[model samples]
Target: MTETHVPEKLKAPVLGAVITVSDRCSRGEAEDRSGPLALARLAEFGVEVAHPVVVPDDIDYIRSALQEALDAGARVIVTTGGTGITPRDNTPEATEPFIALSLDGLAQQIRLAGLAATPLATLSRGLVGVSARGDRGALIVNAPGSTGGVEDALAIIGPLIGHILGQLSGRTHEVESADE
Candidate 1:
């Protein structure tokens, strides 16, 4: 079979994971549609994604899922769900502790792009940030539970993953001055 061409400039197969945070899905009362969708989307960007995981909306459960991904060497972890304004939405709260640096622009871009489709996008409290591990850190982001939100986020993240990863690994195209 012919290989699917990735639209991004990823230098390597990025190790990534997808977490679906939903109380119903975790309890098997609902199917995890978003997690699979997220994995497929990341694959389209040439990301080497791990098996999708599902967790409840509880902060501890969400954090455990994220921690597991990080421990497994995932360089990027995109969480689906738990970003709305509802009380059960806890992905952002769980994720904040891991963020050493916030990528506010990227997060804002997701919301802005989403606004073109629906005003409710403004209600999504998703965030993008990198861990404190510096060169060994991972880019963690929370995408709204809906498939459209995941698509919107990937649209912004896909093209930039290479550069973001590069920056995290201390790779840059900037030329140094001789004065240094």
Candidate 2:
């Protein structure tokens, strides 16, 4: 018998949440551009934004917000800010417990690409992982605080979103041409 190869296409509806982890933003003292930027970027991919929130940088606060978004049915959660080396940056620590699988390669790629523009990008200690809490699954990634950094991360992951969603939904067909 000969083995046949088949291509896969994503059918599951993709929902997203954007969390801006900044104390001032949560307090309404600062405007949130990162969360909105994430929402806009994901919108181009046809992913619906389910919950967009601004939370304090406290570890527990960020963790609770993430849990809330996940519970609200967000299949992808993109977080900005609080991933640096500063004392107040606790997004990474807060998200550690909820992670099911860490995608180090994706995180590394983001870092590598960002490094070309600014050395400060190397200071980011952001992470990417999957959540084990839901039946639909969620991919959680920490994007840099800067607008350019966010753009770089989005560009790097944009093409992969559909493929990732397809795998998560168990679809098996080619949805777009390689030229896309």
Q: Estimate every model's Cα lDDT from 0 to 1.
A: 0.88, 0.80
Model 1 ranges with Cα > 4 A deviation? 1-8, 175-180
On the 0 to 100 scale, the lDDT of residue 36 in model 1 is 92
Model 1, span 5-92: residue lDDT tens: 3433776787999999999999999988889988998898778886789999999999998899889888889999999989999999
The lDDT leader among the candidates is 1
Structural RMSD, model 1:
6.1
Please report the candidate that would top TM-score against the real structure.
1
* Candidate 1 to truth, TM: 0.89
Clashes of 1: 0
Q: After superposition, how far is residue 74 of candidate 1 from its true place, in Å?
A: 0.4
Which runs of model 2 end up more than 4 angstroms from their true locations? Answer: 1-13, 133-135, 170-180
